[model samples]
Structure formats: C-alpha cells, structure tokens
Target: MSWVLGNLDVIGGHAGAHLLQALPAIVLAFVLALPVAKLAGRLGVLRGGISTAAALMYAIPSLPLFIVLPIVLGTSIRSMVNVIVALTLYGLALMVPAAIDAFRSVDGDVLRAATAQGYGPVARFWAVELPLAGPVLLAGLRVVVVSTVSLVTVGGVLGVPSLGMLFVDGFQRGITAEILAGIVLTAAIALALDGLLVLAGRALMPWASAGKAPAEPSPAGAPDPAAAAAGGAA
Candidate 1:
C-alpha cells in the first residue's frame, strides 16, 4: 500500500501506456472483424476455415507471441507495436465468431422488408442490419475490452511498459502491495470501459435497452386498436 501510494505517477504512467496499447487493439480488431464476419455470414464455405484459423491464432501463448511478433513485424522484442498487434489478433479471434453470430441473428424477413422499401445494399447495411446487430456486437465488444486490458500485462514479460510491469517488478522485489495494486487497477479499468460501452449502447440504440415494462394487455384482446388502425390504412 505504501509503495503504491508513493509511486502514484509511476502507476498512472503505466496505466496510460496500458490503455494506449489496449484501445488500438480493441478498435482495430472490431473494425476488421465486421467485414470478415459479414463475408463469413455470406459464404458458408469460408466460414469454417476462418473460424479454424482464428482458433489456432488465439491458441498461441501470449509470451511466445510477444517474442515472435517482433521478428514478423521487424521491431524490437520489447516494442509496444508487438503487444498491440498480438492483442489485436486475439481480439479478432474472439470477435469474428461473435460478429458472425450477431449478423446471423438478424431476421431474414426484416432484411427483405428493408429491400422492399427500396433500400440499397450500403444504405440498408448501415441503417438496418448494423442497428439490428448492435446488441450482440456490443456484447462481443465488451468481452474484447476485458480480454485486451488483461492481456496487456503479458507484454511486461518482454520489458514493455504497462500495468503488467508492476507484476514483474513486485514479484522480483517480493512486494505484494505493488502486485495487488496492478490487479485492482486492471480490474477497475476493465469495469470502467464496460460501463462506458453499455452507456454508449443505450444512447445509440435506445430501442435495444433492456428491462422496459411490457405494454399493458389490450383488455382481453379487444381487436387490438393499433392493429385495427393498420388494417384500415391498408
């Protein structure tokens, strides 16, 4: 506790560095996943191959990935780029399946209705499919957020600056407080990110908000006034 209290600036700098690595990974994975997922949803044959490859990519251990990515990327073993790229790959692995499910969950009937209303491919995708897919996509994104933040610590093993560095230093010096501080701050950052995502989802997709009171039953099904009005208009 005393060590953590005295090294506030050190902790803050590590946390900031941690976010820089994690956020870019999370965002890039999501952006890249959407197109891959859409393509997978459209083509049944490639979906299996993509899924298998993603699984294999994710199964690679983080520490080894940290050591190896530099060779592939032509960077130093301790480069932050290696950490970000590794995390991005992991994020994409998790997100692609989730995104595939999200798009598949949208109703075919709704899309047909959208087409009937003269919506072109791009407009329909942006206005209809994406909005309808928002809830499931958001769920996947939250998982990526937590996973990326936690995994940033793995880079510390390669001497990269992050909250994970606290773990390495604390273990070396036999200081439990520093390790505990790292664990607590990592969790707090994940929770904060998750809360913000939830709030943003609610703001952008108000229709998807949970826990709304059900509409009152129409007094023993008295012809459903709303349905009667629709019938008259038709």
Candidate 2:
C-alpha cells in the first residue's frame, strides 16, 4: 500500500497509457470485423476459409507476432504502434467469427418482411438487420473489451509502459505487494471498461432492456366462425 501510494503518479500514467493502446484496437477490430463478416455472409464459399484463417491468425503467439510485426511494418520493436497493431489483429481474429454468427442469427423472415415494405438493401441492413444483430454483437464486444485491456499488460514485458512493468520490476525485487497491485489494477481497468460497454449498449438498445413482449397466438390456419356461418346461410 505504501508503495502504491508513493508511486501513484507512475501507476496512473501507466494506466492511461494502457487505455490509450487498448481502446483504439477494440474499435478498429470491431469496424474491420463487420465488413469482413458481411462479406463472408454473402460469399458462402469463402466462409470456411475465412474462419480457418482467423483461427490460424489467433493461434499465433502474441510475443512472436510482436517481434515479427516490427520487421513487416518497419516500426521499432518496442514502439506503441507495434503493440496496438498486434492487439488489433488479436481482437480482429476473435471478433470476426463472433460477428459472422451475430449476422447469421438474424431471422430470414424478418428480412423478407423488411423487403416487402419497400426497403432497399442499405435501408434494410441499417434498420432491420443491424438492430436485430445488436444484442449478439454487444456480447462479442464486451469480450473484446475485456481481452484487449488484459492483453495490454503484455506490452510491459517488452519495456512498453503499462501495469505489467510492475510485475516485471516486482519479480526482480521480490516485492509481492507491487505484483499484487499490478494484477488488481489491471483487473479493475478491464472491469471498468466492460461496465461502460454495458451501459452504452443499454442506451443504444432500449428495447433489449425492456423484456420481450409475450408471443401472440398466430391467427393463421384457424377456421373463422363468421366465414362458416356466412357460407351456411348462402
């Protein structure tokens, strides 16, 4: 506790740097995932290939990717950009499959109804398809937010400024308090961001908060008593 109090400024700075690296990756991954998922939905032949590739991409160890990306992009191995890009790829790999499932989960009947109402492709997607997919997408987004925040700590191993630095430094000095502080702080940041995403989702999707209305019985296929009586009179 004394150590935390003494280095409050340092801790705060690291946390800020942590957020700066993480948040952008989360947003970029989501944006990229949507279009790729949409493409995969349209190109049935390509869906399997895309899923396989995303899985392979994610299976690549982060530390090695971090080392290799610098060569590909010509950035310093320790640069913040390198970390952010690596994190984005990891987030993207997770988000793509989840997003594909989200879009696929939308009912085809609803889309047909939207088309019957004279909705163009763009209008139907923006109004019906995207809104229907929102809940699942929100679930995936929450996962990405938590994962990204936690992953930022890995950058500290490479001498990038983040809470993970405490872990490295504490291990060398054998200060259990510092290590615990790092773990606790990293978890708190992840939870805080996740909570914010939940709030944002609720605000954007008020209908999801209101419990689903009871399913009304369908009138189709049931004989109409009035029609039967009219036929008998005729």
Candidate 3:
C-alpha cells in the first residue's frame, strides 16, 4: 500500500496512457459504426459479412495486428496510434452490428410518423430514430467499453506503457503490488466508463421507458363510465 501510494506517478501515467489509447478507438469505432449501420440499414448488404469480419477481427491476435502495422506502415509505429488503429478496426467490426441492432430496435411507428411529418433521412435520424435508439446504443457501448478496458492491456506487448504494460511489468519483475494495481485500475476504469454510458443513455432516451406497461383493459367489454369519468374518462 505504501509502495502504491509512493508511485502515484507511475499509476497516473499508466491510467492516462490507457485512457489516451482507448478514447480514440472508442470514438472512432462508434463514428465508423454509425455510418456502416446506416448503410447496412439502407443497402441491407453484407451485414453478416461486416459482423463476421468484426468477429474475425476480435478473434485476431492483437500482437499480430500490431506487428503487421509496423511492417506495412513501416515502423514509425507510435504505440498510441497503433493501439488506436487496432482498437478502431476491432471496434468498428463489433460496433456496426450492434449499432444496427439498436437502430432496428426503435419503434417503427415513431420513424413512420417522423417520415409523415416531412422529416428527411438526416432530420429523422437526428430527431426521431436516434432518440429512440439511444438506450440500445448505450447498452452496446457499455459492452464495448468494458471489453476494451480489459483487451487494451494487450497493447503493452507492442511497447505502449499502457495500463496493461504495468501488469506486464509486474509479471516480468514479479511485483505483486504492481500487478494488483493494474487489475484494480482496469476494473475501476471499466466501471466508470460503463456508468457514464448508462447516464448518457438515460439522458438521451428518457422516454423509452416512460410507458413500461400499458394500462390493462377493464374486465367488462366497456370500461366503467363512473370509474372512467372519475379517472378522467376511458
């Protein structure tokens, strides 16, 4: 514990590096995903292809992705950039499918109503579709964030002193405290990011859960007029 407190700099640096490494991937992944989702929704082509590719990308060994980048891009390999690129590729692959699912989950009626009200594609997306889709999108993002938090440590194998690198170092040097620190930090970051995603989702789509279960019909064919009238009429 004393050692942990003493090495605040190391812990802080690792945390910052991890966040730096991940933020780009998360944002880029979502941005890339949104359009691919829209395109998939519009064209209805190769969705399985895109998702399978993402799953394949996920299955890919991260070390190899890092290795190929330096070989192909020729060794100007900034760990930050490599991590982001690797993350983005994996991110896009996973997220596009999730995004499409979220978008599809929105009420069809809401979209149709928006369409009837002279909302164009862009307007409708901004005004209606996105609003309804927010909860699902956030749920997927939370999954990605949690996954990325753990997977990101793999980036350290490439020489990024990312959070994972700490654990790697701890293992290499047989430092139990450092290894524990890394695990604890990673878990904390995952929880924090997931919480933020949930808050954002609630803010974006407050109405999605507003009408949880509709009122049941009266047992009689006609609602009781007295009861209905008292309750502001059926």
| Clash totals in order | 0, 0, 0
Q: For all the candidates, what are their Cα RMSDs to the real structure? A: 2.6, 4.8, 3.0
Candidate 2 global TM-score = 0.89
Return whichever of 2 and 3 wins on lDDT: 2
Worst 10 residues of 1 by lDDT: 210-219
Q: lDDT for each of the candidates? A: 0.93, 0.89, 0.81
Q: Rank the candidates by lDDT, best first.
A: 1, 2, 3
Q: Compared with the true structure, what per-residue lDDT tens digits does model 1 show for residues 1-234?
A: 899889999999999999999999999999999999999988898887887787687898888888989999999998899999999999999999889989988999999999999999999999999999999999999999999999999998778999999999999999999999999999999999999999999999988866776686475776777778889999
Which model is ahead, 1 or 2, in terms of TM-score? 1
Estimate the TM-score for candidate 3.
0.88
Where is the poorest 10-residue window by lDDT in model 2? Answer: 214-223
TM-scores for candidates 1 onward, in order: 0.91, 0.89, 0.88
Q: Please list the residue runs of candidate 3 whose C-alpha ends up more than 4 Å from where it truly belongs after superposition.
A: 213-234
Clashing pairs in 2: none
The better-scoring model by lDDT among 1 and 2 is 1
lDDT of 2 by residue, 97-186 (tens): 889989999999999999999999999999999999999999988899888888888888898888888898889999888899899999
> What clash count does candidate 2 reach?
0
